[model samples]
Target chain A: MKAITLNSFGGPDAFELRDVPRPAPGAGQVLVRVHATSINPLDYQVRRGDYRDHVPLPAITGHDVSGVVEEVGAGVTAFVPGDEVWYTPRIFDGPGSYAEYHVADESIVGKKPASLSHLEAASLTLVGGTAWEALAVRAQLRAGESILIHGGAGGVGHVAIQVAKAIGARVFTTARSEQFEFVRGLGADVVIDYRNEDHVEVVMRETAGEGVDVIFDTIGGDTLSRAPDVLAQLGRVVTIVDTAQPQNLVQAWGKNASYHFVFTRQNRGKLDELGALVERGQLRPHVGATYSLADIPLAHARLESRDSGLRGKIAIAVVPPAHADARQPRA
Target chain B: MKAITLNSFGGPDAFELRDVPRPAPGAGQVLVRVHATSINPLDYQVRRGDYRDHVPLPAITGHDVSGVVEEVGAGVTAFVPGDEVWYTPRIFDGPGSYAEYHVADESIVGKKPASLSHLEAASLTLVGGTAWEALAVRAQLRAGESILIHGGAGGVGHVAIQVAKAIGARVFTTARSEQFEFVRGLGADVVIDYRNEDHVEVVMRETAGEGVDVIFDTIGGDTLSRAPDVLAQLGRVVTIVDTAQPQNLVQAWGKNASYHFVFTRQNRGKLDELGALVERGQLRPHVGATYSLADIPLAHARLESRDSGLRGKIAIAVVPPAHADARQPRA
Candidate 1:
C-alpha cells in the first residue's frame, strides 16, 4: 500500500511517498480502501511542526478520508465491506488516511452523501464538520440572527457560510474583491472586500450599528481582537485559528461577548448533519484542485502559497473515482 | 445634599466631599433617598480613570444602592414613595448612587429583600448581580459540574461561590491561606491557597486531570492566560476583570473553551434572581467594613490597600440603618 509518510516535520518536501504495510481493522473498527482525502490548514500546520509534540516522527498524517469499507472488526455493527463511508480519522491517533487503505472506529464513520463523488466527500468531511461544530454546537447560531464570517471564501469559511444560511441566518462574509460574487452565490447576503474595505464599518453600517449576533473567524491575527468592535451585546465569536501572538481583548468585556476557540475533535454526529445538508443540495464543498497520492507535497505547497488562488479545499485522489475530469479550478 | 464627587481622575484624594444638588425624578424614573451604598472594584477602576471616557468629570460614581423611594415620575409604576428598594443604578447613565439622592429608571429596580438591612442589601446588589450573570447566564453552570472561582474571598468571588453552590455545582476556589475557612463556609467544596499552592495542580488532581467545567475569574493577570491548563473540554471561563495587558490564549483552542469577558450591564432580571437566592438564604454578601458618608476618602484608600485585609465589600452608610453596631471586622 502506497502512503505519504512524514519522517521529519518541516516544509512540504518532507512528505515522502513510500510503500507501507496496510493496516487491518481492530476491534470495533472497519478497514477502509482509501479513495480520497483533502488538504486543510491543519495539515500544513502539522507538517510545519506546529504540533510537533502530538505527531512523532514516522507519522501517517492526513485527516480526511472518503472511501469504501473493506472489512469490519469484531463488535462492529454499523458498517460492512463495500459500503461507501466518509469521515475524518481521529486526529493524532494512530495511522491516518494518506495510505491506500485506512481504518477507523465504527462510531466515527458516516455513510457518504450519495450526491457527492468521493473527491467531493473527502473535501467536505473535515471542513464541514469543523464549521458544523463551531456554528451549530458551540455558537448555537439561530435563525433570523446575523453572522459575520471572516475569510468566507476559504475552506471552513465557505462551509460555515452555507451552514449559517441553512440555519436561516443572514450571512455577512468577507473576501477579496475578486471573490465577492463567488461568496454571494453561496448565499452570503452581504459580502465585504476584506483587503479593500473596512469590515467593521461595513458590518456596523449594514446592521444599523447594532452589530452582528455572531462572528465566525477563520482568519487569525487581528480578527479575534477586533471582533468586539463589530459584535452585538451577548454575541459569540468562534475562531478555528490558533494564532501565535497574544491578543488584546479588553474591549470584549463591555459587550459581554463569548469567544469559542475550536480545534474540532472528530465525531459522526456532525458529519451526519453535514451529509444531510449535502443530500438536500443545500451544502457542497468547492474542490479548488485535485492531486494524485504522490502529489500531496505539491498540493501542500500550492495551498501554502499566498497566490495559490485556492477558494476551497484541494482533494487528493488516492484511488481516483470516475468523472475525474469534472474537477475545476473552483468547485 | 452631600456627595462624594470625582472632579478628576487620580488617587483616593481625587474624590472631594462636597455639597451638591439633590436629584429629582424624570419620566419613567424614581428618586431614591439612598440609605446605603457599597464599594466594588468598578469604583476604584472609575476613580483611576479606567473608564474615564464613559464617566465625565465631577461624576458621582457609586453603583449599588439600597434605599427608600422618595418620589416616582410619570409612567413609573413599579414602586411608590417610601417603598424599600435595592438595585444598581444604570451604569454610566446619569449620576450614580454616590450621593444623598439617586435617580433610576423604574424598570431597573428590585424590591429589597425583607431579611436584609440597607447596608447588607447595598453590599450585594452589584456584586450579586455580576456573579449571577457570570455563573448562571454566561457559564450556564449546572448541577454536578465543577467550577473554580479565583479570589473566592474577594467581592465578586464571594458571591460567585454562593451562586455556584446554589446551582448545585461543586465549587473549587482559590484564596489566601487565611481565607480558606471563609470560602469553605460559603459552600466551596475545595479551597486552594493560591499563594502557596498550584491551582492547576490542585484542580487537576481533584478532578482526575479532566479539569473544571467552569472557571469564574475575578482575579485578572495570568488567570485568563493559564485557564486552558485547568479547564475541561468545552469548559467556560467567565472573567469580570478587564486587564490592561494582552493575554496568550492559543492553548484554549484544543479544549474547545469558551471565554466570557463580562463587565455586567445593569438589569432587573438578574437582580431579581439574586434576590430570590437571598430570600431563600442560599446567598448573602459579606460586608467586610463600613464607613460614614463623610469618610469615603478613607474607605477608598482602605479598599485600595493590599494590607487593608478586606475580605468582601465595603459598605458606605449614606443614611445608616438602625443597628449600625452590627458591623464587624470579618462580616
Candidate 2:
C-alpha cells in the first residue's frame, strides 16, 4: 500500500511517499480502504519533531478519514467488509488514514452519510467533531442564546457556525474583510473584521453590552484573553487552542462565567449523528481546496501558511472508488 | 429606631449601633421584625468598602435573617402581618437584615421551616444556598457518582457534604486532622486529613485512580489546583475561593474535566427547598458557637479566629422571637 511516511519529523518535505504494507484490523477494529483524508493543525505538529514523544517516528499522521471497511477484526459485530465508514483516527495508537488503507476502532467509526461524497465526509469528521464537543458537549449551547465563534472562516469555526445555527442560536464570527461575506453567507448573524475593528468593543456593542452567551474560542491568544469581556453573566467559554501565553479572564469571575477546555473525543455514535445532520442538508463541510494524494506536501504547506482565506477544509483525494466500486454497498 | 450601621469602611468595629428610621417596604416588598440574623463573608467585605462600587456605603451588612412580617408593600400577596419567613436580603437597595427590622423583595423571601429555631433558620439562608448552588447547579452531582468537597468543615463545606450524600452520591471531604470526626459524622464516605496526608493521594488510592465525578472546592490555591487531579473523565470542579494565581489546567483536559466558578445567585425557591431539607432529617447546619447580639464585635473577633473542626455556624443571637417587644424595634 502507498503511504505518506515520515522518516524523521521535520517539515512538509518530511512526508516521504513510500510503499508500506497495508494495516491489518486487530480485535474489535476494522481495516478501512482509504477514500479520502483531511488535514488539521495536529498533522503539522506531528510532522515536526514537536510531537516526537506523541507520535512515534515513521508514523502516518492523518486523523480524519472516510473510507470503506475492507475487513473486520475478531469480535466486531458493528461493521464488515465493504461497509462505508468515516472516523477520526485516534492520535498515536491507530495507524492513520494518509495511506491506501488504515485501521480504525469500531467505537470511533461512523457510517458515511449517503448525501456526502467521500472527500466531503472525510473533510467534515475531525473539525466537526471538535466543534460539536465544544459547543454541544461542553458549552451545552441552547436555543435563543448567542455565541462568538472566533476564526469562523476556518475549518472548525465554519462548521460550528452551522451547528449553532442548526440549534437556533445567533452566531457572531470574526474573519478578515475578504471572508466576511463568505462567513455571513453561511448563516453568521454578524461578522466582524479582525484587522480593522476591536472585537470586544464590536461584540459588546452588537450584544447591547450584555455580551455573548458562549464563546467558542477556536482562535486563542490575545483574542482569548479579551473574550470574557464580551460574556454575559453565567456565560461559558470553551477553548481548544493551547498557547504559551496566559489569558487574563478575571472579568468572567464577577459574572460567574465558566471556562471549558474542550478537546474532541472520538465517539462513533456522535459521528453518525453528524452524518445524519449532513444528510438532512442542515450541515455541510466547506472543502476549501482538494489535492491529489501525491500532492500531500503542497496541501500541508498551504494549510500551515495561514495566509489564505481557507474557509473550510483542506482534503486529499486518496483512493477514489471506481465506477463499479461506486455502486451501492451495505452502509 | 436603632440600627447597626457602617459609619466607615474598615474592620468589624466599623459597624456602629445607632438610631435610624425604619424603612418602608416598596412595591412587592415586605418589612419584617428580624428575630435572628447571620453574618456572611460578603457582609464583612461590604462594610470594609470592598464592594463600595457595587453596594452603596453607610449601610447595614447582614444578609441571612429569620423574622416575622410586620408590613406588606403594595401588590404583595404571599404573606400578611405575623407570617414567619426567612431570606438572604439583597444588596444596598435592600436595607439588610442586620437591624431590628429589614425589608426584602417578596421574590427573595420564603416561609421559614416550622421545625428549626430562628438562629438555625438564619444559618440556612447563606451556607445552604451556597451548598445547593455548588452541588446542584455547578457540579450537577448525580446519584451513584462520587463528589469530593475540600474544606468540608467550613461554613459551606459542612453543608455540601451532607447535601451530596443526600442526593445518593458517595461523598469525600478534606479537613484538618482535628476536624476528621466532625466531617465523618456528617456521612462523608471518605475523610481526608489535609494536615497529615495528601488529599489527592488518598483520593486516588480510594477510587483506584478513577477519581471523583465532581469536586466542590471551597478552598482554592493548592487544593483547587489539585482538584481536577481527582476528577474522572467529563467530571465537574466548582470553586468558591478565587485563585490568585492562574493555572493552565492542561492536565485535566485529557479527562475532559470542566472547571466552574460558583458565585451563588439569590434564589428564594432554592432557599425554600433547602428549608424543606433542613426540616427533614436530610440536612443540618453546624452551629459551632453562639454570641449575644450586643457582643457582635466580640463575635466578629471570634469568627476571625475560626479554627479547624469548629462545629456549626458562628451566630450572634438577636432578639429571640420569644421576646418580641422586649427591645424597641431598630426600625
Candidate 3:
C-alpha cells in the first residue's frame, strides 16, 4: 500500500511517499481502507520533531479519517466489511490514516454521516469533536446563554459557532475583517474583527457589560490568559490548546470561573453525536483545500504558511474512488 | 474607638495602634461591636503590600469577625442589639474587622452558632466559607468518593477535612508527623507526613493507583501544578492560593480534569450553612494562637514566620471581655 512515512522529523519535505506493508486488524478492531484524511496542527507538530521523543520514528501521523471497513478482526461485533466510518485515531497509537490502509479499535469508529462525502467527514472528525467536547461536555453550554468564541474562522471555531447556535446560545465570534462575513453566515450573531477591534470591549458592550456566560478559546496566548476579564461571574472557559504554558487564574478566582483544558480523546460516542448534528444540517464541514496522497508535503506547507486563506480544514485524498461525489473538494 | 491601621504597606511593624472615629450603621447595615477577628494569609499579604494597588491605604484589613450587634440601621431587620453574629467582610470594601467596631451590610452577616464562643466563631468564618465553596460548590464532591486535602492542619484544610468527611467521602490529608494525629482526630481517614513521605506515592498506593476523586489545595506552589498526577481521570483540583505563578496544565488536560480557583465571596447564606454545621457538631474551630488587639503586629509576624507551631488560624481579641471563655486560645 502507498503511504507517507516520516523517517526523520523536520519540515514538510520530510514526508516521503513510498510503498509500505498494509496493516491488519487485531481482535476487537477493523481494517479500514482509508479514503480521506485531514491535516491538523498536531500533524505539523509531530512532523517537526516537537513530539519526537513520544512518537516512534518512521511513523504515519495523520489523525482524522473517513474510510470504509475492509475487514473485521475476531471478537469485533460492531462493524463489518464495506461499512463507511469516520473517527479520530487515538493519538500516539500505532499506524495512522496517512496510509491507504489503517486499523483502529471498533469502539472508536462511528458510522459516517450519510449526507456528507468522505472528504467532508474526514475534515470534521478531529476539529468537530474538539469543539463539541469543549462546549457541550465540558462547559455544558445551555440554551439562552451568550458565548464568546475566539478564532471563529478556524477549523474548531467554525464548527463551534454552529454548535453553539444549534444549542440556542447567542454566539459571538472573533475573526479578521475579511472572514467576518464567513463566520456570520455560519450563524454567528456577532463577529468581532479581532485584529482591528478590541474583542473584550466589543463583547462587553454587546452583552451590557455583564460579559458572556462562556468563553471558547481556540487561539491561545494572551487571549486565553485574559479570558476572565470578559467572563461573567461563575462562567466557564474551555480550551484545547496551550496548556503547556503557565497561566495565572487570579481573575478566574475572583469570578469563581472554571477552566477546562481539553486534549480531545478518541471516542465513538462524541463522533456519533456530531454525526447526528451533521445529518441534521446544524453542522456542515468546510474543506478549504485538498491534496492527493502523494502531495502530503504540499498540504503541510499550505497549512504552515498560514497564507492559504483556508477557512477550515485541509483534506488529503488517500484513495481515488470510481464515482467521487460532485461536492468532493480538489486542489 | 481603637483600631490597628496601616498608613503604608510594609512589614508587621507598619501597623499603628491608633484612635479612630467609631463607625455607625447606615441604612440596611449593622454596627457590630467586634469581639474577635482572625488573621488569614490574606491579612499578612495585604500588610506586606502584595495587594497595595488593589487595597485602600490606611486600611483596617482583617476579614473574619465574631461580634454582637450594637445597633441596626433603618431597613435592617436581620439582627437586634446584643444578637451574636459572625461573617466575613467583603474584600477591599471600606473598613475591615480589625477594629473595636465595624459596620457591615445586614445581608452579609449570619447568626452565630449558639454552642461556640465568639473567638471560635471568628476563627471559623473565613476559612469555613473557603472550604465549603471549594468542595461543595466547586468540586461537587459526592458521597463514597475519595479526596486529598493539602495543609490539613492549616485554616482551610482543617475545615475541608471535616466537610469532606461529613459528605461521606474518604478524606486524605497532608501534614507534619506532629500534626498527623490532630488531622486524624478531625476525621481524616489518612494522614501523610508530608515532611518525610511523598504524598502522591502514599495516596496513589492507598487508592490502588487510581488516585483520589478531588484534591483541595490550601498550600499551593508545586502541589497545585503537579496535582493531576494523583488525581482520578475526571477529578477536580480546587485551590484558594497561589494564583500568581504560571503553572503547567499538560497533565490536567490529558486526565480531563477540571481546575477550579476559588476566591471566596462574602455572603450570609454560606455563613448560615456553616453555622448550622457548627451547631450540629459536624464542624469545629481550631484556634492555634491568640493575640490581644494591640499585638496585631505580633500576629502578622507569627504567621509570616511559618514556624510558630500554629495548628490553625491565629486569632485576635479585638475587645477583650471581662470574663472571656476559658477555652480562649493563648499565645
Candidate 4:
C-alpha cells in the first residue's frame, strides 16, 4: 500500500510517498480502503512538527477520509466490508488516513452521503465537523440569533455560514471583496470585505450596536481578540486557530461571554449529522482543488501559500474512486 | 446623606467620608436607605484605579446592597416604602450602594431573604450572584457531575461550593490548611490545601485522572490558565477575575473545554433565586468581618491585605437595620 510518510517534520517537501504495509482492523474497528483524503490546517501543523511530542517520527498523518470498508474486526456489527464511509481520522492516535488503507473504531466512522462523491465527502468531513461542533455544540447557536463568521471563504468558515443559516440564524461573514459573491452564495446574509473594511464597526452597525450572539473565528489574530466587541451580552466566541499573542479578555468579562477553543473531535454521530445535512441539500462541499495520491506534497504547498484564489478546502485523491471519473480538477 | 467616596485611585485610605446629596429615584427605580454593603474584589479594583476609565473618580463604589425601600418612583410597582430588598448594584452604570441612601432600578433589586439579617443578605448578594451565574448559567452544572472551586473559603468560592453541592454535584475545593475545615463545613466533598499540595495532581488522582466536569475559578492567575489540567473533556471553566497574561489554550482545545469570563450581571431574577436558596438554608453568608460605614477604608485595607486569617467576605454596615442588632461583628 502506497502512503505519504514523514521521516522528519519540516516543510511540504518532507512528505515522501512510500510503499507501506496496509493496516488491519482491530476489535470493534473497520479497515477502510481510503478512496480520498483532504488537507486541513491540522495536517499542515502536524507536518510542520507542531505536535512533534505527541506524534512520533516516521508517521502517516492525514485526518479526513472517504473510503469503502475493506474488513470489519471482532464485535463490529454496525459496518461491514464494501460499505462506503467517511470520517475524521482519530487525532494523536497511531496512524492517520494518508495511507491507501486505514483502520478506525467503527463508532467513529459514518456512512458516506450517497449524494456526494468520495472527493466531496473527504473534502467536507473535517471542515463540516469543525463548524458543527463550534456552532451547534460549543456556542449552542439558536434560531433567530445573529452570528458573525470570520474567514467566510475558507474551509471551516464557509461551512459555518451554511450551518448557522440552516439553524435560522442571520449569518455575517468576513471575506475579501473578490470572494464576496462566493461566500454570499453559501448563505451568508452579509459579507464584510475583511481586507478593506473594519469588521467590528460593520458588525456593530449592522447589529444596531447590540452585537451578534455568536462569533465563529476561523481567522485568528485580532479577529478573535476583538470578537467580544461585536458580541452581545452572554455571546459566545469559538476559535480553532492557535496563536501566541494574548487576547485582552477585559471586554469579554464585561459581556460575560463564553470562549470555546475547539480542536474537532472524531465521532460517527457528528459525521452522520453532517451527512444528513448534505443529503438534505442544506450543506455542500467546496473542494477548491484536488491532487493525486502522489501530489499530496504539492497540495500542502499550495495550501500553505495562503493564495487568495484558493477559496475552499483542498482535496487529495488516494484511490481515484469511480464517482470522480468526470470530476473537474478544481472547484 | 453620608457616603464613602473615592476622590482618587490609591490605597484603601483613598476612600473619604463625605456629606453628599441624596439621589432621588427616577422612573422605574427605587430610593433605598441602605443598611448594609459588602466589599467585593471589584470594589478594590475600582479604588486602585484598575477600572479608572470605566469608573469615574469621586464615585461611590460599593456593589452589594441590603436595605429598605424608602420610596418608589413613578411607574415602579414592584416595591413600595418599607420593603426589604437586596441586590448587586449595576456595575459601571452609575453610583453604587456605598452611601446611606442609594437609588437603583427596581428591575435589579430582589426581596431580601426572610430568614437572614441585613448584614448577612448584604454579604451574600454579590458573591451569591457571582456563584450562581458561574455554575448555574455559564457552566450549567448538572446533577452527578463533578466541580472544583478554587479559593474555597473566599466570598465567591464558598458560595460556589454550596451552589454546586445544592445542584447535587460532586464538589471539590482548594483552600489554605486553616480554612480546610471551614470550606468542608460548606459541603465541599474534598478540600485540597493549595499551599501544601499540587491541586492538579490531587484533583486528577481523586477523579481517577478524568478530571472535573466544571471548574469555578475564584482565585485567578495560573488557576484559570491551568484549569484545563484538571478538567474533563468538554468541561467548563468559569472565572470572574481578569488578567492580561496569555494562557496556553492548546490543552483546552484538545479537551474542547469552554471558558467563561463572568462579570456577574445585575438582575432581580438571579437574586430571587439566591434569596430562595438562603431562605431554604442551602446557602449562607460567610461574613468574616464587619465595619461601620465610617470604617469602610479599614474594610478595604483588610480585604486588600489578602490575609489568610480573613476567612470570608468583609462587610460594611452602612445604616444598621433593627434585625442586625444581634448579628455578630465577624464570622
Root-mean-square deviation of Cα positions for candidate 1 versus the true structure, in angstroms = 2.4
Which numbered prediction scores highest in DockQ against the true structure?
Answer: 1
Give TM-score values for chain A, per-prediction: 0.97, 0.95, 0.97, 0.97
Per-residue lDDT of A317 in model 3: 80
Colliding pairs, model 2: B286-B312, B286-B313, B287-B312, B287-B313, B288-B311, B288-B312
Q: What is the interface RMSD of each candidate, in Å?
A: 1.2, 2.3, 1.4, 1.9
- What's the interface RMS deviation of candidate 4? 1.9
Global lDDT of model 3? 0.88
Return whichever of 1 and 3 wins on DockQ: 1
Best by lDDT: 1
The digit string of per-residue lDDT tens for model 4 on A1-331 reads: 9999998999988999999888888899999999999998888999999889999989999999998999999999999798989999888988988889999998889999987888888988999998999999889999999999989899898888888988899999999888988998999998999788899899999989999999998888888778878999999999888844666677888888999989878788889889888888999889888888899999999988988898888988887755543454447
Give residue A75's error in model 3 in angstroms. Answer: 4.0
Q: Taking the tens digit of each residue's C-alpha lDDT, what string does model 2 give over A8-71?
A: 8888999889898887889998898888898888788778776687777787778888888999
Check candidate 4 and list the clashing pairs.
none
Q: For each candidate, what's the DockQ?
A: 0.71, 0.44, 0.60, 0.58
Instruction: DockQ for candidate 4, please give it.
Output: 0.58
**DockQ of candidate 3 relative to the true structure:** 0.60
lDDT of 4 by residue, B1-331 (tens): 9999999999998989999999999999999999999998888888999888888778988899998999999999889899999998898889988899999999889999877778888998888988898999889999999999988899888888888888999999999999988999999999999888999999999999999999988778889778889999999999888845666676777788899999867788899889888778898888888888999988888888888898778888887544544555446
Candidate 3 clashes between residue pairs 3 or more apart in a chain or in different chains: none
Q: Which of the two, 2 or 3, has more lDDT?
A: 3
Docking class of 3: medium
Model 4: residues with Cα > 4 Å off, grouped in runs? A321-330, B321-330
